[model samples]
Target: MNVAVKAPVSTLIQQAAGRIAPNWPLDKLIAVNPYWQMRQLSMHEVAVNLSWLGGVHVYGDVSHYQHVSDDDLAQALSALGHELTVAQFKQQPLKQPQPWQNVAQLADLERDSEREISWNDEVVHQISQFAGDYFASQPQTGAGCDDFYAAWLDTICHDHGLEILMKSKGLVEQFKALPSDATTLVEQALTMLGVTDEAQVDYLHALLLSINGWASYSAYVGWQAMLAGKQNNVVEQLLAVRLAWELVLWQQLSSSELQINWKRQLAHSNQLKGEHQAYVDGLQVWHLANEMQIQQGLHQQLRTPLPAKDNAALSLQAVFCIDTRSEVMRRALEAQSPSIQTKGFAGFFGLPIAYAVGSYQRPQLPGLLAPQLEVREASSGKLATAQYSAQWQKFAKSSAGGFSLVESTGLLYLGGLVKNTLGLGKAKVTEFGPLTLSKQGKALPLSEQADMAAGILGSMGFTDEFADTVLLLGHGSQCQNNPHEAGLDCGACGGQTGEVNVRLLCQLLNDAAVREALIERGIHIPDATTFVPGLHNTTTDEVIVLSGQVPEQIEQWLAGATEQASSERAKLSASPDAKQKARDWSQTRPEWGLANNACFIVADRKRSQHLNLGGRSFLHDYNWANDKDFALLTTILTAPMLVTNWINMQYNASVTDPLKYGAGNKTLHNVVGGNIGVFEGNGGDLRIGLPLQSVHDGQKYMHTPTRLNVYVDAPKHAIRNIIDAHDNVRWLIDNDWLYLYQLRDDGICRYHQGYWHPVQ
Candidate 1:
């Protein structure tokens, strides 16, 4: 197919490929904003583009708006300065389709009656299967093939089953004759489709969106490469593969009349802009109103003045991650005794390090940053038993002995399965001894350790006035037979438990030499003060001391807090026993896992300690007065705020459009390529985002589909300065991806486009 191309096809291909957001694998599953690449565009503009390109819903449907009370809707619209009536808005029609449809979709519409399978489904299935094999953790057949497109082509050319499934006899021959290069294939496809210059990017993007699952995974590869200061073109290759399939279908089904009609439709669609303005505008109103209603409730809670600080401190202070789940625990712990002060910070505790266990090294930091240091077990005695068990499992799964081993152990497996079913099986625990922190395989110097300690304390505003004992509690969830368990773990720890980072931080803060170095710098720790490391099991609401001796009073406080928090959590779950919920293999909603998350408050705990946020707000303790130059505030906004936005958007997207953006039914999920992602059934695109059960209860949605409302206790000018300095922060705010509020002495104010207004 030697078709002449007129547009900058390569540039368009790259531009289209860049639209796909990265999907981290199951092992390090982090919530990603699906429209992150389109942040420069306004939400309304994105709504139009996504609708036109992929029929994606950027906001809630009209039915979702019914939940909002008429009075609330009126108040919300008034707050936004919109005059649309509730009746009129409710009557608005749904978004209509654009004429620009992918060729694969057209092929499916015109599929032969005899063929039960659709071309679109077959294409997605074939590509998904090939991608699963290509991107497998352990490479299957195409180990040496570095180019994804070339590998897929090479594999498809010999696969006779695809030809039969696609019901095309010469498909293999056609694949064998296709261009070997991605760019060439893309150019040829564009030229053949007669896609105009204005429509090329949209057409290419639509093609990628058809197989968005693999494209997202490919984008993750590019994201990691970019993080390492390198370049990757796997997304572009995936786009080319998608285009090739379109080319194949077009050639087989091409007709003079059909070609003319398709060209006309493409040009017409390109020309017809704002065709769904009414629908989009109505949706925007509803979206804004919903967010406003939530914002108002949050404001009501945070409006109270902070109480006077208590100078008399005894017992201990506990610091926890700013995760929404931690709010309940922190609130409960403080309610136990007035002597205990709980603060919130990022779970990694300001340590950018990776933890090495056995032969595998996992980064124990946020996904936004790479590991700067390493921590490993100080003793190997506890690891031997774990390693031996792992080796035995590996041997049992090996091809050489798999069947025989399974046959010999079949009865034992059955017994274990029965025990698990009856909830009699005990949870497995892999213990680690003391940890040693290092940089470049060498011990970190005392000065560097002190610098890290100072940075942690300074950023978290923990300078001055130390308690007799300070507990650093990191959190992790416990769930059995869940492939998406990492999603429930600490995202700040790159989807792993916060054990290593907290324990390592404790070691640094407790070091005598490091403390001496810190004293030389300006910060001082009392000789009587001690640092303790603990793990907050989010599933069971138990705080387990990992090391050192916590005082008896502090222990009692934790026990009381656990009892209260567990009781509160039990009301939300199906079963009253939290431990059984963690062990039950069939328990779909082990814990809500940050569902209903709506607001993030960056202020003193005292501002919100009195009011219950219903476990929906991410609380970070920050005192702007303590932070000079706004550096700490900048870090909080840039890192933790952005991470929370990603989480909020992931939930929003999953709720607004569950099938396209969410992993479908959890019961139907089949783990693909050993944790790459899940397939709803045997074959389809790899499902990304939370499952339906995560966001939806059996009867109704659990997560409110509202953008995150971030309330920062900083000066408006300081917040604006940070936003002005960072393009991403500016984009997120200016484009309405999230709402930023400034906490002032008078009241909370909203920030919009370099201006602030009393949040009505």
Candidate 2:
């Protein structure tokens, strides 16, 4: 390849690699919008692009449209002001595919059709296995290599098994002729494939989508690097490796006739880039109609006029995460007594911090933001003993000792297995202690603590009111033998329990010096006011007090609240005993983690407090009056709202296209590389997103595939200003990734093209 042509090829490679969104690993797993990077394009464009590139669907199948009542479709069309009739819309073509197969896929279709093994499958398997070893939690024996591409090249060149497995005699020879560096390899591959400049991006992207799970995992490495103010080319390198595979296949299987077919396919792919307008338009209209119907139901729920402001002094005020699951607890808690009030805030409670235990550290805030503060565990002999025991357990489970240990301890493990199988074993809670603001061997100043306390208080709209005992309840879920346990935890806390952040915040708020500093800053904390930390166990709807001494009255209120909330949740769950579900090792559907979440309301809780949202809406308590200049509102829209949209879209995409977006059958999931991701039935591209069991219960889908409907209580102008200022935010709203609505005293108004239109 000529050096002059390398620049554009590299640019194309970079652009192609940008299409893959990051997939956080199992331990710190968080929901990510698979199309997040492509937000710059309209949702319709993405649907068309993905359809042609990978045969992926971006909306519900044609059956969904057929099943939806004609009246609902007509009303949805009317709501969106579309002129298309239900019959005409139904007649519109279903998702179409273009003849745009890559070299590996083409080879598999033409040359390897008679073979027992597919060339494409072999390529994905090889790459996925290499990725697993290269990024393994514990380094594999032969997985060592500094550069991603270089290691792959070295591994493939030496691996004689690949030639035998692929059943191609010249495969290793073709690989051996490849260039040393990723940039050079990519350039050469494009030149040999005769991929035109117009089609290079799409071609590269298609190659990546073939192994999307690993591509997404590599993108996560790059995402984390970028977050830390650095750049990582792992995604580009992985793209090059994928492209190289195509080049190898092209070399081994190409014929004069096949060469012409390849050229035609590339050209056709370029020509078909924007050719699905009719189908895409129909999808948009249908999706909007479905969303409108859901919105109408929510509107009815919020139709009751807001009750007159309650001035009665409260015995206690409890704050919970704005997560959809928290809505049930908050509602039930308030129902315990009129005097008891509840508020919702982001799960991490506005603390940008990471939690550290000995040698291990992880973020305790949303994935959108990097941790600025570090909270380290205080020295304790009990913690030391726990860490030592954990290390021994880790050693026993390692590849080297696992078989021997299992053989020796087979009888010893029987009792525990029986207990777990019978739902008698208690969930093991990791014990760690007294947290301090210490980063890199130094304790942070008291002023830093005071600053954090004041900022969170202000953002949470706690500037004016104070309760004698305010319980800050963070949430987590309990389940046995679940690799995706973190998925059930607080996403805003970076897929960890909110216990660390909430406990740390309570300590700061209770500090005498922090209180003195707050008073000086014009925010008053009543001396009698005590901040208590608690954990809301979503699995059982029980509140576990972590540190503070709760008032007798407040304890009684929490007991009543938990019982009522558990009863409400039991109706939706398979088993009435929530505790048994948590303990059951075979319980694939443990409490439906954020399954039906479709709406996010950023307004005072009073706006929808009386309505039973059925644990579907994420309620972030916001009082626009307290937020002068709309700074807090801007943060809410840009950060928390964006996070919720990611969560919503993760579910939406999983439900819409589970094969491409969701991790397959939980029963077949084999955890890849310890924590990177899972592989269904041992070998495939690493699975990402929620497993099928997370959103489906065998017969029916538990989650409705609705795009997020965000209801914000703010001036239309303020919402417009925020949207105008942020290009990504504008893309999400205007492109219909999610529906945005302005909550008003009169009625809810939907946002479209910089204007707000009132709902009927």
Which prediction has the highest lDDT against the true structure? Answer: 2
TM-score of 2: 0.94
- Write the residue-wise lDDT of candidate 2 on 1-760 in tens digits: 2123544667888899999999998878999999999998888789888877887778876555444668888887786578978888777676664536877766665654665588778888999999898888433111223399998899999998877776768789888999998998988888877777766788888888889898988888877877777667888989989999888887887776667777777656546655655555567677766776787799888778888877879789889999999999998999877888899999999988888766577899898888887887677778778768867664443333334555778967656646866767776564446788865567877777777788899888788788999999899997766778889999999999999888888888888988998888788999899998899999999998888588888889899998999999888866799977876656788879899898999998889988899999999989998898999999999998899989998998898888889999988888777678899998989999999999988878888878898999999999999999998789999987888998888888999877778888
- Global lDDT for candidate 1? 0.82
What would the TM-score be for candidate 1 when compared with the true structure?
0.94
* Per-residue lDDT of model 1, residues 1-760, tens digit only: 2345666777888889878898888878888889998898887798877776777788988677676778777876676677778777566576655535677766666667574688878889989999988788433211223488888898888899877776678878878888999898888778877776767888888888788888888888777777667677888888889889888878876866557667767757845556655556667777777776787788877876677776656577899999999999999999987788889999999898988766677788887888888888776765777667867754443322334554788988667646865777775553446778889989888788888899998877777878989999999997766777888989999998898888888888888898889988899999888998889999999998888787787888899999999999888766788877776656787888899999999987777888888789999999888888989999999999989988988988998877678989888878787768999989999899998888877988888788899999998889999999999999999998998999877898989898998865
When superposed on Cα atoms, how far off is each prediction in RMSD?
3.1, 3.1
Candidate 1 positional error at 622, Å = 0.5
Score every model by TM-score.
Answer: 0.94, 0.94
Q: Candidate 1 at residue 740, lDDT?
A: 92
The regions of model 1 sitting more than 4 angstroms off are 1-7, 75-84, 95-99, 113-115, 137-145, 271-273, 307-312, 389-408, 417-432
Residue range with the least summed lDDT across 10 consecutive positions in model 2: 137-146
Q: Output the lDDT of residue 295, model 2.
A: 76
